[model samples]
Target: MKFNQYIFLLFSLFFLMSNSYAEINIKKCKANQGDYIIFDEYDSQIAEKIIDYKLHNQPEKRENSIIKIFANENSDDRNYWLASIQTDNKAEDYLFYQVDQNKFTEVDQQQFQILLPKIVECNQIKEVPIYSENFDAD
Candidate 1:
């Protein structure tokens, strides 16, 4: 390659490398003990079947709330850097975006979905709900 072409290629590689992006775990969405990810945007219709999510007029609160940590990315397309579904949210979810992450009160249409639900507590005596899809016999 010519000297100028070589320089151009080197510059391009440097430019690409300079841009930082969030590290994502490609594992299929599941519960984690600590902070995990929520890569996919919300789909309300699909969520209704697999897990019991936010229901209108009835605030859902359990002993534990499911959460995921979204590292800030360098893309203009996505604004949410963090998303959460607390038991105290009163059936509504929240999205924390890049602009004012600590202050945002409402979830946007682009907010990440709760793809993985962390099972918290099972208090029923002697009987497990075998009807649950997530139930594991082992």
Candidate 2:
């Protein structure tokens, strides 16, 4: 009975620790109006453009909201960056993106948590307008 109790306690502690580690704290930030561009790890011109292009064309679909950007480059020699966006809405829809592909891919929250540390470490999370004078120089 004592041995069983010890095992149960050990399992409980492991479960708690694992759960704590799995939970990643993503800072909530305002999404600035305009474009959110994440440059590719290899090429500056190649970027993932996050914007509501329909703001002028499809006003009905436009939602007034901000997006928080999280990004990081892969460790391998191949140039790749893992990026994620969280909207400033109550629902907080989180979307993951592969900058090289310029497309959003389905990813589990667990995966998000794993890459988050690296994302915050190497990338600067900032809000930039969709249309910027800086873009004109490119």
The prediction achieving the highest lDDT against the true structure is 2
lDDT of 1 by residue, 12-127 (tens): 99988654333322222222333422334332222331223332323233334443334222222233233444454445364433332323334433323431121111112112
> Quick one: best TM-score, which candidate?
2
lDDT of 1: 0.34
Q: Which digits, one per residue and each the tens of the lDDT, describe model 2 over residues 11-81? A: 99999877664333333232333343433443333222433321233333233433334443222221323
Q: At residue 37, what lDDT does model 1 achieve?
A: 23
Q: Candidates' lDDT values, in order?
A: 0.34, 0.40
Model 1 has how many clashing residue pairs?
0
Clashing pairs in 2: 31-66, 31-67, 34-130, 35-129, 35-130
C-alpha-based local distance difference test score of model 2: 0.40
For candidate 2, the 10 contiguous residues with the lowest summed lDDT are 129-138
- Each prediction's TM-score against the native? 0.24, 0.35
